[model samples]
Target: MSEDLSSKLLGPIKLHLRVTWESQDSEIKEYIEEGIAYIDGICGESDYSVSGLPRILLKAYCRRAWSGNTSMFEEDYRRQLLRLQHENGVRRLRRKRNE
Candidate 1:
């Protein structure tokens, strides 16, 4: 949990890292390796990061991608709602039943 530890999701990819000298070398290696694999699957063959790219750039890219996805999803949902309302009478009154 140093300042160096960071995590980000870019597009469909995520990048994470944890650095320490706790002598838990196996755990450390697994953590970093898993990050790489996750990123690869999410990115799906994109060179999202340049060689020797700075951490800040990666973070910014991830934020943009994540937010963009969210925005798109919201828009799509709204459109679907509009379509449904149009198909059904949106202003139709609901009939109350007497018990």
Candidate 2:
């Protein structure tokens, strides 16, 4: 696959599934698209980059959304999401103080 198309294949949506490229069927793609859409609905218009902590949390959230069951896992992800929000709030406050 060309670089452009390969990147396009995974653009905006990141999948943590173990399927090979050959086995990436429509069903799996639909799940990923749904997960990505779920995250985007909450996170707004970010590029969904892999660097930010919030983005990482969103990925975990997407994974949980795709899994369908396991509320325990969802709770854990929610806790982490809250922690990230708290940490970001602290950083914003510190920045404001120093300004």
Candidate 3:
């Protein structure tokens, strides 16, 4: 898929990003969320996004945590072990110390 970003006055800025074609749709979203959690643990919430999170942060953090050497996330898409990925998911990931 190609997306053309443009301004009324400015012509365009074309950004080409990777696209993943997979059988597991819901699993992938959950996978990204798991990666985000791992990344958050590493980065400690600096300039996080307004919905309060961004997938790219997880990407970059994975770049850092895995020493830029592994694709652990894509290979290891997370699942709700113990019902963790609820609306309480973020809260649960945050409570590591409290636990």
Deviating ranges (above 4 Å) for candidate 3: 1-22, 46-55, 60-99
Model 2 alpha-carbon miss at residue 33, Å: 9.3
Weakest ten-residue segment in model 1 by summed lDDT: 3-12
Cα lDDT of model 2 by residue, 1-98, tens digit:
13343244353334454445644455445544554465444433333435575556545554565566435643566665566556656777787999
* Over 4 Å off, model 1: 1-22, 45-99
Candidate 2: count of backbone clashes, pairs at least 3 residues apart or interchain: 0
**Residue 2, candidate 2: C-alpha displacement in angstroms:** 25
Ranking by TM-score: 2, 3, 1
Top TM-score model = 2
Model 2 C-alpha lDDT versus the unseen true structure = 0.51
1-99, model 3: which lDDT tens digit per residue? 011111110111011112244343343334344545555454443322322233344444334343444465433433422222342456657787588
Looking at model 2, which ten-residue stretch has the lowest summed lDDT? 1-10
- Mind sharing the TM-score for model 2? 0.45
Of candidate 3, the 10-residue stretch with the lowest lDDT total is 5-14
Please give each candidate's TM-score: 0.28, 0.45, 0.30
